[model samples]
Target: MPDGPHTAPAATPPLCEEEIARFVVERFLPGVDTGDLDPEYDLLATAVIDSLGVLHIVGWLSKQYGIVLPDRELASRNFRSVRTILATAERAAAVGAQP
Candidate 1:
């Protein structure tokens, strides 16, 4: 059988806190000013992210980072705020990138 096309690995775009914040604003809280989003804002407590919203976020995170989020990891704590979400995404990406 012929081997897969021998192409070099594609470059991964940089992941930054600003990007995460922007994504949150655009995806979850559309029409909200990006500057108003606090990194420590409690999305769940404030009703910004509900049960269905969490599913949307999980789907976005999976497709965006190419990482799989286990059912157990989908806790309020992990999706508490922009900072927490970024941390979770980075960790998941790292784990997924490993052999």
Candidate 2:
């Protein structure tokens, strides 16, 4: 991934957790219904996101949100569940938007 700040088109919609869940469910965690996804479930513990999944998600996030998730924030806790992922994503975007 690029080490510099990221940017997107002005009309691109902001990041949404639903999109994230959709991507994960459709790509990595099929057979799992997003409607029943627990916000606090430990995704890594259940193998929902393996190493490859991590790279995929991080890449997708960077492209979609135009944010660089700092190396320190790549830990399991931040990506633990639906809620945490959304929170971490929002934080990254917010920080990246700063001047």
Candidate 3:
């Protein structure tokens, strides 16, 4: 046997673009298929999400990812697209995991 056995690294909470897309389509754009939602779609430009919707999304993110979103992360830019939202959530979760 080897002196030290290898072990898997701690798994970070995954923030996937598909998951974000599914949430957005379900919550804000009912009847819209997730397949139609592109990664770079302009959710704000298309009126998919408003200020109140943004708050709802922020709340969902905080609860789902177990991270308190910083005030700066509440910006609409962070939720502009599926890619952006996933990136922001992943970043926030990573930061929140630190001591």
Candidate 4:
């Protein structure tokens, strides 16, 4: 008991990969089992998410990250897999954080 401020280090926000995976599993999947949706799995080919789901995911991402994703950037190449989504989110976050 010899501390003045007793301040703790600030915690960093989750990385892109972590954010994307957590959002998908927790928000998108809801009650469904997430065992089948591997991080590296092909979201489109495997039908893990459909068109409407994509929109939902995009909206969720925008809302959660405070980044608006245009439709042109909402292609399969950007949101096809977890890795891609992570990359996209990272880029968006970087840009959004810029003054």
For every model in order, what is the number of clashing pairs? 0, 0, 0, 0
Q: How should the candidates be ordered by lDDT, best one leading? A: 3, 1, 2, 4
Lowest-scoring 10 consecutive residues by lDDT in candidate 4? 28-37
Tens-digit lDDT track of model 1 for 32-81: 99888999999889998888877877887776667677776788799888
Model 4, 66-89: lDDT tens digits are 677766677877878888887777
**Best-performing candidate as measured by TM-score:** 3
* Residue 90 lDDT (model 2): 87
Clashing residue pairs in candidate 1 (N, C-alpha, C atoms within 3 angstroms):
none
lDDT tens digits by residue: candidate 2, 1-99: 999889874785656777777777888777988777767778889998877777778888888767789997787778877778888888887888889
Q: What is the lDDT, from 0 to 100, of the residue 12 in candidate 2?
A: 57
Better of 2 and 3 by TM-score: 3
Clashing pairs in 2: none
lDDT against the true structure, each candidate: 0.81, 0.79, 0.84, 0.73
TM-score, predicted candidate 4 vs. hidden true structure: 0.67
TM-score of each: 0.77, 0.77, 0.80, 0.67
Best lDDT goes to which candidate?
A: 3
lDDT of 1 at 81: 89
Better of 1 and 3 by lDDT: 3
Which segments of model 1 are wrong by more than 4 Å? 1-13
